[model samples]
Target: MDRSSQCDEPSSPAESPSPPAAHGENEKNAQFLTGLRLYGVLIGTSVASFLISLDTSVISTAIPSITTQFHSTPDITWYASAYPLTLCSLQPLSGKLTTIFSPRWTYQTFFIIFLLGSLLCGVAPNSSTFILGRAVAGAGGRLSLYSFGTILGPIMGGALTEKVGWRWCFYINLPAGAVTVATLFLFFHPPQKKPATPLTPREKLLQLDLLGCVLFTASIVMVLLALQWGGNQHPWNSPLIIALFTGFSITIIAFTIWEQRQGDSAMIPLSVLLRRSVLFSVLFASLLLSSFVIPVYYLPEWFQIVLGATPLQSGIYMLPSVISQLLGAIFSGVLAKRIPYYNPWFFLGSSLLCIASGLYTTFTVFSTPPAKWISFQILQGLGCGLAAQMPLLTVQATLITSPAQIPLGISLVLFAQYFGSSLAQSIGGAIFQNILASQLEQEAGLDKTQIQELLRAGNAKVRETVAESFPQSLNAVLEAYNMSIFRVFWFPVTGSAVAFILAGGIEWVDLRDMASSEGSENRVVDEFSKPGAKQGGSRAGV
Candidate 1:
C-alpha cells in the first residue's frame, strides 16, 4: 500500500489548513488510507508484529522441552534472554537504519534476517545453536511490535508444542513470516521524503554510529550476563560477576560520551532526547509500559507451578489481562482522538496500574479463586491498555508537523521500552531465583544439599517432582513460589508509582487539532477547558 500523502509542504502562517471540525472528521480522514492496498499493508504489519512478539514467550513454554532435547540445564534462561538482549541492543539502531536507508528496504532486510534465524532455531541440534538463532531473530525483529507478539505467544507455543513438537514453535514462524513478507512486498511502501542532504555512502554509514552501537550493546550484554549468572551460576560476590558489572558501567559511560560528542548523527540522537515530550515518553515507556512484562512472564509460571495448570490453560487464564489491555488501548485511542485532553487519561491509567500491581501482590497459593486473579488481571490490563501506547502517541503528536523527527521520536520510545523490559526481566529473574532458593532452604525445610539440587532442577521440574516425591514439602514449596512471585510485584508497583508521577508531565495534545497545519504550535496545549469554549473546539492554551 503506497499510502503516501505528498509531504505537506512547509506551511507559512497564512497557508495553514482549515481547523478540523466537530467529531474530528478531518483528523480521522487524514489518518485513514483507503483501498485494498491499505488493508494488505495493515494486515502484513499486524502479522509481522504477532510473530515478533510471540517469539518473546513462545520459547518460554517450550523451555523444558528444549532443555531436555539439548541436554542443557545451565543456559535455559538464555533461550528467552538472548533474543531480548540483542533486541534491546539493536532496536535503536534499527530506527536509525530506517532513516538512512529506505524504510521499506530496511524492513525487508530485517524480515529476511529474522526468517533465517527462525530456520536455524527450527533445525538446531544443540542449545548453543538454538540460542544463537534466537539472538539473531531478536536482533532482526527488535524494532517490530513485540508488545503485541508476546500477548499470544504462550498459548500458541503450547498448542504448537502439543500438536507437532517444540521445534514447530520456531518452524511456525517460517511460513507466517513468509506470508507477511510476500504481502508487504506486494503492497507496502511508505511515502518517501527526500533527505535533508544527499550524503556520500561513507557519510551515511558513519551516521549509523556503528561504534557507539557496538559499545552500548557490549555494555548491556555484560549487565545481562551478570544478572543471568548472579546468585545462580555464580555467587553474587564473585569476582567474575563484579568484573562484568564494572565493564558494563565503564562501557556505558564510554558510549554516552561518544554519543554526546556525535550529537545528531549518533544512533540515539541527543537532540531528540533533550525534548520534553521525548524524554518523558522514554521514561513512561521504560518504567510504566515495561512493568507489563512482569505479569506477562511470571503469571504463566504462577499458573503452572502454584496452580498446577498446563501451559495452554495458563495462557487461557491470561486472556483477561491481555484482552482488557487491548480494549483499554482501543477505548483510550477513541477518547484521545475525540477529546482534546489526554493527560487525565494517562493519569487515570497510571493510577489504576499502581492499584492493580498492589492487588496482584496479594496473590497466594491458597488464593485459587478464579474471580480474584481474573479481576486483578482485568484491572492491570485495563490500566496498561489505556496507557501502553500513549507515550509514543504523545511523541508523534508533538512531532506531527515535523515529519523528519517522527522516526527518531518513535525509536527513542521503543528503545526505552525494549531496554526497560529486558532489564526488568533479568532483574526479576534474579530476584525470583534468589528468593526461591532461600525459601526452599528456610521455609521448605530442605537441607542445603536438597536445596542445591532443587535449584539446579529448574522451577517447572522442581514443582512437579517435589509434589510427587515430597508431599509434606509441597505446600511450603508452593508458598515460596507464591512469595517470590509476589515480591516481584513490588517492582511494578514502584515502577507504576513513578510512572504516575511522570505521566503528570505529559503535555496535552489534541488529536483533532494535530491533523491541522498548526499542530506543532498547539502540540503542548494545556489540559483544562477554556471558558466559553465551542463544542468540539480546541481546548485552553491551544
Candidate 2:
C-alpha cells in the first residue's frame, strides 16, 4: 500500500497531542522551513507545470487534425477525456503514494510516465493507438505541469502552431522531460530518511479499508463514464445512463459512510475534510475550475465554427488566456508572501472572472468585437492565475498542518476542480452541442448528411464545401454557437459566485502554526501515495 494513501496519524479532529517531540513544533511555529524555501520547489514545480499546462491547449489546435486523422468525434474526444479521467481518479491516491515513496521519487516517476506516454501519443499510428497513448501519458499526469502549461499556453501554442506542426506539441515533451529528469537526479538529493519504526502487523491489517477504497473508485468511475456517454451515446432517459448514474450514487454514498466510519484510518482523513480552509478551498476551486475549463473545451469549437480559423489558428487565439494564468500563479504566490491578507487576491480574481463571464453572456453574433473577446479572456486569465495558489495556500493555512497531507491536500483541491469540470463539460457540451445541432437544422435547411459533410470540412472544410451556398447553413450554426457560448458563461459566473462564497468561509489559520503541524503530519504521511490515489475516489474534493 502506498503510504501516502493510508495515513496512520489522526488526520482531523486533532488527536490528543502526544508528547511534543523533544524538538517538535506547536501551532505557533509550524513548518516555516518549507515556506521559506518555497522558491526552490516552486521554480522546479513551475517548469514541470508549464509542460503539462502546455499540453492541454496545444491539443486544442490539433483537434481538427485529430478528427481528420481519426475520422470520428468520439475518438478525438477520447484524447481529451482519457487524460482527465485518469488524472482525476488518481489524485488522492498520490498523497498516499508519496508517503511510501517520497515526493522526489513520486514526482520523478510520474514525470517519466507522462513523457513516455507523450512519445507514444505523438507517434501513434491509429486513433485507438493514439488514444491508448494519451491515456498512458495522462495517467497520473502532473498538476504543476497543468497549471504552468495553462499559464504559458499562449507562448507554447504560438511556438507549436507557427514554428512547428501540431503533433510536435506532444513530441516537444521529450527534451523537456529529459532535462527535468536529468536535473532532478543531478541536483535534488533526497532528504535523509528519518528512521521510522516498523508498523505492527495488526496495525497494518486493521488499517486496510479495501471495501471503502473499492466503493470510492466505483463512484468516480461510474460518474465519469456516465458523463462521457450520457448525451452522445445514450439519451438522458436511457437505461444505460440510469444504471450508471444509479451505480454512481450508491457507490458515492457507500464511500462516504465508509470514510466517516473509518475515521483516522479512512482513505481521506475526516479531520482534513472538516478543516475549514481545506474544505472551502476545495469547493471554491471546484467551482472556479468549471469556469476555466468550459472556455478551453468550447472556445476551439467556437473558433472553428464562428471565426473561420484553422484548428491551429484557433489554438493560437486561445493562447493569451493561458499566458495570463501562468502570470497569475507566479504573481499570486509571490504576492501572498508580501500581503498577509490573502482573500483579497482571490476576491479580485473571482470578481474579474465574474465580470468577464458576465460580459461574455451578452456576446453578439460573429461580429462581436475581437478586442472584447480578448479583453474578457485576459481578465478571466488573470482571475485564474490569482486564484491558482490561494486555495492551496488556504489549505496550508487552515487544514494541513503536516507535510504528509500537503501534497494530498493539494491534490484534493485540484481533484475537485477537475470533478466540477468533468461534470460541467460533459453536461455543458451536451447542452451546447445539442443546441448547436437543433439551431443549425432550423437555420440550414440541410439534413444530417449535409451537416456531417460540412463538419468534415474542418480547417479547410468550408473552402471545399460541395455547395457554394453553404454559408446560409453556417449562419444557423454560428447563431447557435453564439447562444451556446453565451450560456456557457453562466457556468463561470455561477461558479465564481460560489467560489467567492467559499473564499469568505475559510478560516485564516496563521502560517506560524504550519511548520509544527506539517512536520508531525509529514511524519505520518507514509501510508498513502498511490498514483491512482484520489483520481476519482470517493472524496469530491480529493
- Tens digit of per-residue lDDT, candidate 1, span 1-542: 00111111111111111223332544353433459877877777677767876787786666655655675545655675677677767866665565566767777788778878999999999878998998899887754544456566777776776568888988888888988788778876554335457888898888678998899889988997898789987998999999999999999999999999998777788888888877887788788755777777677778877898765677688788877877887687666666666577667777888888888888889856999899988888888878766676676666656645655676677667767777877777777767877887888888877766655565556566686667779889889878988898888899889988998777776555555655443432311111111111100000
Give per-residue CA lDDT, model 2, range 466-521, as digits (tens): 34646655566557657765776677788787788778887655444443554643
| Model 2 bad stretches (over 4 Å) | 1-50, 74-78, 102-108, 125-129, 143-148, 158-165, 181-217, 327-340, 400-408, 455-472, 508-542
Once model 2 is optimally superposed onto the true structure by TM-score, how far is the C-alpha of residue 302 displaced, in angstroms? 2.1
**lDDT agreement of model 1 with the native:** 0.69
- What count of clashes does model 1 give? 5
What are the RMSD figures for all models against the true structure? 8.3, 7.8
TM-score of predicted model 1?
Answer: 0.81
TM-score per model over all chains: 0.81, 0.76
**Whole-model lDDT for model 2 versus the true structure?**
0.60
Worst 10 residues of 1 by lDDT: 533-542
Clashing pairs in 1: 1-187, 1-188, 53-149, 53-150, 54-149
